[model samples]
Target: MSYVPYSVYQPLTKNEVTLLRKKQFEKWEHYFLNPIQIGQKHTEFTEVRDVILQSWNRSKEYQDLNPMIEGSVKNISDEELKEIRKKNEVFHLAEPVLKQAGQELSDENHVLLFCDSDGIIIDNYGNHSVSRNIGNSVNANNGAQWSERWAGTNAIGTSIILKQPIQIFSSEHFSYNCHEWVCSSAPILDPLTNELLGVINLSTTANSFHYLSMMKTIGLVNQIERILFHNYYQVREMMQNIYIEAISKWKNQIVILCNSKGKILKINNDTQINEITSLMSVTVENNECTTKKEWEDEVTLHGSQYRAIHKKIFWYDRFIGFISILEKKSRLSHSTTIHNHFAKYSFQSLIGNSEEFKRTIHLAQVAASSDSNVLITGDSGTGKELVANAIHQASNRFDHPFIALNCAAIPKDLLPSELFGYVAGAFTGANPKGSIGKFELANKGTLFLDELGDMPLELQVQLLRVIQEQEIIRIGDKIRTPIDVRVIAATNKNLVEEIQMGKFRKDLYYRLNVIQIELPSLRRRSEDIPLLAEYFVQKLSVKKHHGPHHITAEAMGILKNYSWPGNIRELENVVEYAVNFSANGIITPESLPMHFHNQQTLPINSVSINPVKQAELDWIIQALKRSQMNVTDAAKELKMSRSTLYRKLKKMGYDMKSLK
Candidate 1:
């Protein structure tokens, strides 16, 4: 009989078919004497053996081409095994198989085998009777070595070794003692790539294996394979549908699906039909319009300024169809409340209310009133972004989009495409459907570029061009699309210094610095601590879902004295820590962080201005002065320990050398 290829739709390589056959025959020959083995007659086993051996030989010749390690033994770690189970989801998918197999194989005589990636039997059928024999042997879970070489030939290992199917009878089993049952196994192929997913086997205490039993096992394997294949295909289809929907909804683009012959299968009518109808009327009325080839973006919509960009679609490198998207020069005007544009976010959402904060907000509002580019300068964590957001809200474009992007967050190589948008498939891993960048999204609105100092020099030049020309050409495309986005840039580094260091473009800085807002650190606004602390307590309580917000006067005093290096962010953290850990209704000095509470020695908090303390200090100073500023003598006169007096003086910012 002529042998058919293993997989009908997508045939496996001859080498693969050979290997699978060889493994099947080897296991078949070794298990022939066993009652469980399927092929009983010597003649039948011999033919099966020859066929498998020939397949295996041919499979080995192409061993180098196999992506999987052939015949390699792996000591699977627990974590690795768990990962494999997660990827395979065998337990999840095996329920239906078990149900079907249970009906076919009698409950009293059946064994369902679960193996590791290497086919080492880790579990068996839930039945106690069939499981008893599998528990204590070297071939069982604890002692089993899942390799064809270790067992000299077995269904599980050889099926995996050759990536094929096999059945071993009771006596044909290589192990000397265990030949009471037959085992049938098949390689579970991955639905997507048709790789060897794993092996599924059924063992039972039955007579010599028959074609009927082997066929049942193969049927179970196919069922499981179908489930896996369907899952992958369904997930991919769902994701594609989601992408198509998102593009239509958010971007208002059109999507067309067509057959290879270019007949339209589907058309997502995301664009305005009235506009398309007008275009058709114009083409029909003007005979000149029918014969002339027009650039996609140049194709006016029914004599309207709006144009359509034509893009092709492909799936698996097959041309699906073409899509025409009507491109509007500006965003649609909406009749919603202007406040709703920033309903979820606003200047009030900013974390602080310090004098410095008020000053920053005022300047931001001033900058926003004008269309001039605004540059915000500050140290890291000084609320530069808050200022930017505030400015966006204050601008004439407040009702329009307000998009923020961190220049430093994007990789240098991809920053250009990330900022300026890109043509579809401009480079490897580029979005096939293309994407609109933040700048385009912010057209007729404000673009807040955070950490602008970190932008690459090449991208800086491109950005400058956009700012000056009021247009952008996507990467890999030359059509200059007009844009109208107000640029609001912020940086922690000084652009002058950056320019001197050759890290920032001086010309770009000049353009961006048309209006500037500088944010001051929290330490400079220590006077606002009491009010800010109260605000923080309320905000933190609400955010943390805690109740009965209160802060002791002592804690507020401690907060006011600390020089916050991390600025408002650090202050928020301290308040949050107090709110989370403090059990009392009021957060006290004791409730403050250990570092802040113990920093009583810091001069900012010490009572250095008191006259009594000063008199005592002065008397001690006089005594030390008379004793040639000897701290020991001074301590004796003050009747305190030398260390105590020294600490007091240091806390008071009194230099011992100056006292001497």
Candidate 2:
């Protein structure tokens, strides 16, 4: 014997079905007429479905809906509905499916309604006669708001609330105006995010209600979801290809692919997959990862710290995932070295128009085209690091890291470790998990070494060897690791003079001096002072969160005439000071720093010397006083090559030995 499949509803004769619907209709009518009588006890409407009964109660109590309303009262304007349709992806993608369903049900007295997640009908297709008949009473047309609160107990609104498929029979509708129609609706959700995109509703006349309608609606929804998933898969495949290319470009770094929710999807460096996954897991568990488009943070795993940078990936304006790159943290904690590992300035951002400054920029550009080591020479605050950053940004390795280290900033003992990383337990105070050095971190990129003249002689030998061999041995390890770093050394002290003084390695100097760029002091390039001042005024004003104050002609003259010994750095400080004190948004003479006012008087013999020469003389005198007339200490203080300082002193007829 053949077995019958189980069913939720027992088989009922046509006559019985008619009788049940009649009872349901009567209960709905009675509840509509005297809702207070039925409010006290739900048992009064025993014939009504529980879901529909609850909806009816909510429509009356919470929504205060009137069953006697003529038609949908919350219909959006045509222009508004058009805009909604334009932004909705599912509406466009499900067009073909919706059209097919509409055609199939055209002669069956049915209409297909497409509603957004908010249950506002965005589109309708099917038999015009059926649509017109139902729309006349309930306004079940395009742009009609069908949410439960607005239209009452409909399939689209109820399914939206439940996030599931639902069928509302004729009398089950809360509003009397909708009692003549039936609707089957299922939500269309994003396959990747599981977010409700919209709903597909199949509607028909009350007498034409069929149980199979619900199944058809669900099938249509499934088809739409499949299309969405297929599109998503294509985008994901494209993203994978992009990541693979990035992996090749960034071979040594750890690259990760994550979904919008911060879940790891793929990783480039499989050898460190376990460690990377552990780090990501800890980050996610601690809620450190967020939905921001781009961010960087430090994460620790296995007792080792790493800097993870996340950048969101988008396809067709839809957020797909994130491309994350991880770098092993170094021992240095200075803001310049630790946080800013990438070049932030380009050649265009370097502000200068004077012939002298322009010549320096042209040389720097030429140096950027080559792979030779660069030596930038200038006084303090001459923007040597800025030039270094611009060169790195304009170089072929711009996509890679641009690591900067100040040779004078770090202590002599710790300098070696900061240059070449050590393994765990390499030293008494070393991190247990080891740390990466600037050389390793800067592999395949440029390393800017500031204050190169201050490097200890012993370390200079190691630096020269590393440059020659293109490799480095960690402080505590004997194994030499290959590296591909383009060294760009900068200093206010002349390296040639340091070599003469037996303080610098001659070979290292030759290695680094392959390309030389000397930035001019502010006094020498006084023609560009106004431009620089204006640029700083605009830049610093924004930080102060006020008007972009302008410098008065008199104030600008004061800035131009005053000798800037501190160069561009000093100029920026002065501008920032003016911005802070410029109470009326206009920088005047009074807004200038006090030092500028003090330099108004000049000695009799100084009148013959130009402002630039006088500024240099003043700096030399200050440095001599600060160093107790010692040439070496004075050279260090002046940031001038010691040999060069002696020549200047001799030209000025100042014998240091006689002064002492």
User: What TM-score goes with each of the models?
Assistant: 0.42, 0.44
Give the Cα error of residue 332 in candidate 2, in Å.
20
- Which window of ten consecutive residues has the lowest lDDT sum in model 1? 1-10
TM-score of 1: 0.42
Runs of candidate 2 exceeding 4 Å displacement = 1-340, 603-660
lDDT of each: 0.62, 0.78
lDDT of 2 by residue, 531-647 (tens): 999988765533332343679999998887766767889899999999788865689989988877776342224235767887888777755643435677567546779889888
Q: Please give the TM-score that candidate 2 achieves against the real structure.
A: 0.44
Most TM-score-accurate candidate: 2
| Count of backbone clashes, every candidate in sequence | 18, 0
Score residue 589 of candidate 1 by CA lDDT: 77
